[model samples]
Target: MSQTAPIRVGRIGYLNVLPIYHPIEAGEVAGPLSVVSGPPAELNRLARAGELDVTACSSIEYAMAAKDYLLLPRLAIGSRGHVKSVLLLSRHPVARLDGKAVRVSFQTHTSVALLRLFLERRVGIAPRYESGDVTRALQGGERPDAFLAIGDEALRLADHPDYPHRWDLGSVWLDWTGLPFIFGVWIARRQAAVAAPQAVAEAARALVAAKDWSAGRPEVVARLAAGQGGFSEQAMRAYFEGLVFDFGPREQEGLAVFFAMLAEAGHIETAPRLEFLDI
Candidate 1:
């Protein structure tokens, strides 16, 4: 890429991240940035392929490919508890779903891993896992015993009458470990950071500025995000309020615990050291 070329940044196509991306999209934070939007899994793939210079991707993806990326400090998508978005909807109790078919969303990697840890380690039930279109299945009135949903889909299906039992993965993890759950984090590709240090730093600063701008105006952010996921303004406000956008000490500690558990459970080969960009 040319030195003058714009930095290609990946944005997660979920309302949860609107506060960060909306400002950048609206030119509130100025930088030579070209934004690409996609689901979490797609963003992870692009980041792994070196297609995106900077991106907010699944937390697990960062660990799996930590050598290729440097974390952007003070930015993450996490929850102290009750993340309302990442949910496990089931017809039966989670502990009783052994051997039953539970459809998992293909749009997720971290949530699926977390769900596995929850069921096998915490709930003590191993359900048959299959990858499928959970939203389509639910819309078509084809209810499997259970299904995992994340992002806007989870928010939409959170109160659906068909599934009486809903488990918030964030809350479940918090209860199990007494730590926050970091779903996603902003990262810069190592090559990008090394090749265009100033560009990467500018992009990182723009992201922090955007977050700061959104911090003082939750109602405005909520209003902007309303209807993007069929959620009311009030609901969006509450959802945004529940999310933690800072990658502080507590969030890092929580992420460390999660990575350790993922390694212990064989979901990952090994726990990775969190590598952050100096800028």
Candidate 2:
């Protein structure tokens, strides 16, 4: 690659990723880099198309694309315990979701599939899925008994006190596997990490630094979250404090359990061995 080649970085447009990209946007960190933001699905597409050198992708996409990618070290979109942003909103209780109608977000298939497995294998309920937004599906139509929501939308649901019943998937995953749930992880082209080790290290440093800075400063979080995801001060604070970024050994147990569960449920044909690219 030429020196002029922009190091394309793919990321999701959500509050969960604010720390990873906020510094780049704020000019606190800089180098030969470019940021591309979208939903998890779009990021996966970009990474698969060779349009991105590095991307924070959904766990399912990472497993599917494992043959050609490597995980970025010490970085991820993780939750130590409960993450309110990944949720299941229901008009009825979760126990009543068996064979119930549910609207699913196509943008977040991995989490949805995992939830399905939990309810089936763990909770012993198998629900039917439909394609539609939560609000639209419940608008006097075949209302979704429950809706699997993620990212900024799920955060909004967390703030909805009147929503009555909801389940934080992260909490459920942790409860079952006794580990944190990592929703997104940074992945790079298999060749890129080998050929451009310095660049990869630089990128990892940038992300870690950005994460540290954002964690300590609520001001930065508030500014970025407000404009990027319409996240309020309270919500931003919760996001910054609740989500963990390090993808080190301490979190590997959780990640391993997650991969195993996905494979067992047939969402992933085989569990991909995770290796954090040592920068």
Candidate 3:
């Protein structure tokens, strides 16, 4: 990587991350970054393909490929209780959905894994899963018993009349484990960190500063994101209030527990060690 080249950073193209990215995009926090926008699944693919130097990737994605990445400390997309987004909307009760087909959004990885952990492990039901665009399918009058929705789409479909039984996955996880659910974490490729430590550090500091700046101006952030999700400013504010962006000790504990559970359930080979970039 040339020293003059901007760091290629992956940004999840969702309203949930606007508070952090909005500032950077608006030039409130300056850094030598070339932002690549996509959904979590796409970003995860980019990270795996060695395209993204730094990204806010799915937490489970990082766990699956821990050897290739180092987490940026003190930054995450999590929820202590009800996330409002990242939902499982069903036509029937969750307990009775065994053997039913559940269409999962192609835009997720961590939410899919988390949903499986909830249904297969906690509820003791195995639902047939398939990938499709839930929003488009629903608009076309196709219903597959249940569907997983995340980010802005989830927010839009939160009160859809067609799906009366809705389960907020984050809330469900917290209720089951008594810990916050980390949906996404900022990370850098180990190779990138080693080759351009200064660039990585600059990106990390810019992200933290953006988060801090947004934290003090919730109303402004809400207004900026409200239009994207078709939500009122107040609703966006409440949604932001429900989210946890800091990766502190409690969040780390929750992530550890999630990894342990995934390993025990054979989703992953083993719980990878939590490694962080020393920025």
Candidate 4:
């Protein structure tokens, strides 16, 4: 616990965030920042615990800890429609699964919340759910009635023919609200933002610049995503292109819609008031 360390930054170490981290990944970019990478859930926990000064976090985690964090403007992992990852694969028709058990990935919070909202609102049936490694559960000879997989794993499981009913949560959200679905965002600890305003702003600059730099080189991200997960290069290309990294008005509206639904369904106490870094 180095109190005097330069802003401790965190990011999800997965292909989904390549556009934002590509410059850093290329070993061509350096700054007065301590970068710590982990899975989404781990990063979220580290951010909430104040171990990370700034982190790429699940929107659900941001919503839950809104008072302690300030969103870094103009960056996110969201999709307008047909996100190739973030899947809900069911053994039975989704609408008919009333009391069946489902396994959800332990690494995602936003996706799990969205899964519940979609199940109750769209399918009108609330199935029992447990969090675990979906692949491990299946490989261990335990077949849950249904399973939710997100990120790279979802993209891989989608090609399986046994799971006939595959639902892309992002596409469902688009269909439900005609807006983009935001899964993750970069948030700064409020105290860190106030005490190290320049550092926070500088980090924002680096990240936004990294995003711009990667935006110009989609081939780099496509190749990385495709090769890492054994996913089709064409599919990865489309996936990378389909994602919207901006935290503009339209993206905010989509988040508002999602929070409202989560609140109405009692998944959360209320929708959080979004706060951004003063920079």
Candidate 1 residue spans exceeding 4 A from truth: none
TM-score of each candidate structure, all chains considered together: 0.98, 0.91, 0.98, 0.94
CA lDDT of 276 in candidate 2? 68
Q: Give the TM-score (vs. native) of candidate 4.
A: 0.94
Q: Encode model 3's per-residue lDDT on 95-153: one tens digit a residue.
A: 98999999998888889999999999999999999999988988898877999999988
Candidate 4 Cα deviation (angstroms), residue 210: 0.6
Which candidate gets the maximum lDDT versus the true structure? 3
Error of 3 at 265 (Å): 0.6
Residue 24 lDDT, candidate 3, scale 0-100: 92
For model 1, how does the per-residue alpha-carbon lDDT over 37-154 read when each residue is reduced to its tens digit?
9999999999888899999999999889899999999899999999999999999987789999999988889999999999999988879999999878777879899999899888
- Could you give the candidate ranking by lDDT, starting with the highest? 3, 1, 4, 2
Candidate 2 residue lDDT tens string, 1-279: 543566778878887787778787788877567889889988888888888888889877888879989888778877877887888888888888888877788887668877887788888988898766765544545545678888877876664544567888888887877788788788888777766777766776787787777767777677667776766777677666778787877577777777787788877889889866776
Task: List the candidate 2 regions with Cα displacement exceeding 4 Å.
Answer: 135-142, 159-163
TM-score of candidate 3 to 2 decimals: 0.98
What shift in Å separates residue 7 of candidate 3 from its native position after superposition?
Answer: 0.8
Better of 3 and 4 by lDDT: 3
RMSD to the native, candidate 3?
0.9
lDDT of each: 0.91, 0.78, 0.93, 0.84
TM-score order of candidates, top first: 3, 1, 4, 2
lDDT of 3: 0.93
